[model samples]
Target: MGIITDIVLPVSLAFIMISIGLTLTLGDFRRVAAQPRDFLIGAVSQIIVLPLVAFALVTAWRVEPVLAVGVMIIAAAPGGVTSNLLTLFARGDVALSVSLTAITSLLSVVTVPLIVVTAHQHFVAGSGGEVAGDLTVTGAVLKIFVIVTVPVLAGLAVRHTMPGFALRFEPLARRISAVLFVLVMVGAIYAERANIGSYFAQAGAITLTLNIAMMAIAFYGAAWLGMRRPQRIAIALECGLQNGTLAIAVAASLFHETLYAIPAAIYSLMMFGTALAFVFLVTRGRPAAV
Candidate 1:
């Protein structure tokens, strides 16, 4: 059952990626060229600043070395598709949000493994080998490319080859993806059920603090970058949010380490409540998007 659950996640994620590709085009990226500063800010914050923030939070919170690496992996993850929905709700620039998601997702094939390996090495050195066993550099890289990049490319290929068929399948794809995402959450919870009490006791505060901190970093980072209101909201949503479900899948399937999966599991639970509150605060009294 655990092995089957592992297979389901990447398959569902592939469908979700295909749906995104079907809805996007090169023109979306071209639009970013007209707003170079916003594009640069969003990219840099995601690729550089956010991961650093995660590392700092882990250290400051005194998270266990293994769990700290988990936090960094989640941090290194791309902006989720859900951010586009949240941006739409916040009356943000949907195009910018979509563009950011697209770019970040493309970049994660390089960045995620880099972040994971770097964190693994750092924690191993710092903790005198108390880190979660290192995921082999070669195997980790191969799995990331195969598991993440392959599905994204396959999705894109389907979109390119059969636009009509792609459109027809997208809604169903989304519904399936949504259901699978929920199931992943449920499975994660069930898998962690026995350890829930201790997991929370050991790392709940760290997880909560990191969640709030990153969200705040994203919000303030966007504003500080002088992004317009809508773009700021979009960047905030993207920066703070992540695909924790995917992280859980990586931990469970790719890494086969349930203990290492707990941080993402905790994050999956925390983000919904926090992100909803953020959408409320940012969008509550604002006029609706046109």
Candidate 2:
């Protein structure tokens, strides 16, 4: 299990992220500059607001310290490729969705480490002193860069160099990513099976609360800011669905703690159900695409 968590999980996560990159083009980044207001709204909501919300929830719930940090780690993770698919299905702005995913992921190379280190200091060290060989900001930053950023950049390179090939392979890549995600979820659950029920009992409600709150905040906040329906839907899904595979991999590979990965695995399951219901509500009377 250690070998699988430490080795296979990270590698698989990198592949999933690379597959995401393969779907991206330079235009995805350019779209942010093209429409700065919409992009900024989504980016701020994702990179800033969501983590703050997660922290507040964990602190309010008096969650176990390690699990609190784990939840924070999930919050710090960038939006997943699943958001793009959900956006498409929800009749949202798929371009904006992809742009947010790409930008947040790149920014997470910085934000994730900062948030995780802060959570560790506050929850882990502040409460009970330090754990030796604990994850440091520098190590977290480097590992995220290597595992997340590098693969994404490689995928972007592939897209740029072979546009046709990239397009042709994207559907298959997405399918592969889906499969890898399931396997990672299984690995995480299996690794923590002994304590699965207790972990879920501990973090399940908190994670569910976090997920629903984020979606509502994103959707209502975007609407309040007068964003169009499509953009609102995009923001809602992006904020709601995190990159759980990355979160789990980070916990298992970087922290080597099954308890740390439990929140992510549970959150992954919770998000799908919530996201589907959201899709149903938003799409009931709307056109297929806006």
Candidate 3:
């Protein structure tokens, strides 16, 4: 796992982001105009409600200070690519899913840092003890820009300037990204193995509760906002699952603490199962509505 992280994982994540960016055009945002309500609900739910819910859970659970920061980091990071796959599985709006990914990921460079600072100021100030000089907002942004945004922009540029090249390489890029993401998960798990038992033993109920609540908010909140079934599914999955790899990266690179990184590692493993159950429970017998 450590070997993978030091090599394949970083490269793959960059490629994955680039692949997603390659599929984009200005028209993606234009499409949002056609379904403003769905997009608005999804953005609000993801950027606002999801983090708030996470913060509340972290507080209620009395998570270890470092672990609470991890939760907030996950909340701050962009929605995962997994959301799009889950959206497809649940037969939701694919265009909306793609648009949401593109928009949120692009916005993450700014939003994530702000979220991180705010979470720290609010949640960590009283907790006492600064992490280290390495864990600054600028450091977090630089890491994210390198690992996520740059590859995406590079892929997007390639797709735009050399369409034939992009067409040929797109699939390979996505495969690389997937392999990298998996490697990041493995690295995180291995790195945090010693702390896993303690984290779950103390934070397990809180983690599960937070996951369930986030999932519920996606569907129920979207429904309350009068979103259609498809949009609800997309928003729900996005809310429930987070970019755990990014969280771990930020925690490790920016914060310099494994304790702060472990939640994301555990979350990466836990969310897949939790999200699958959610899909089955929410979509069963309904058929693919969208």
Candidate 3 per-residue C-alpha lDDT over 185-234 given as tens digits, one digit per residue, 9 for 90 to 100: 77776777876788777666666777788888788877887778887888
Q: Candidate 3, which ten residues in sequence have the lowest lDDT sum?
A: 1-10
Put down candidate 2 lDDT per residue, 6-90, tens digits, no spaces: 6778778888888878877878878878899999999999999999999999999999999999999899999999999999999
Q: Pick the candidate with the highest TM-score.
A: 2
How do these models rank on TM-score, best leading?
Answer: 2, 1, 3
Candidate 1 has which clashing residue pairs, if any?
A: none
Clashing pairs in 2: none
lDDT of 1 by residue, 163-210 (tens): 789888876776776777777767766777887788877767777777
Compared with the true structure, all predictions reach lDDT values of: 0.75, 0.89, 0.76
The TM-scores of all predictions, comma-separated, are: 0.91, 0.97, 0.90
Candidate 2: lDDT over CA atoms?
A: 0.89
Over 4 Å off, model 3: 1-9, 134-139, 164-172, 288-290
Where does candidate 3 clash, by residue pair?
18-152, 135-254
Weakest ten-residue segment in model 1 by summed lDDT: 130-139
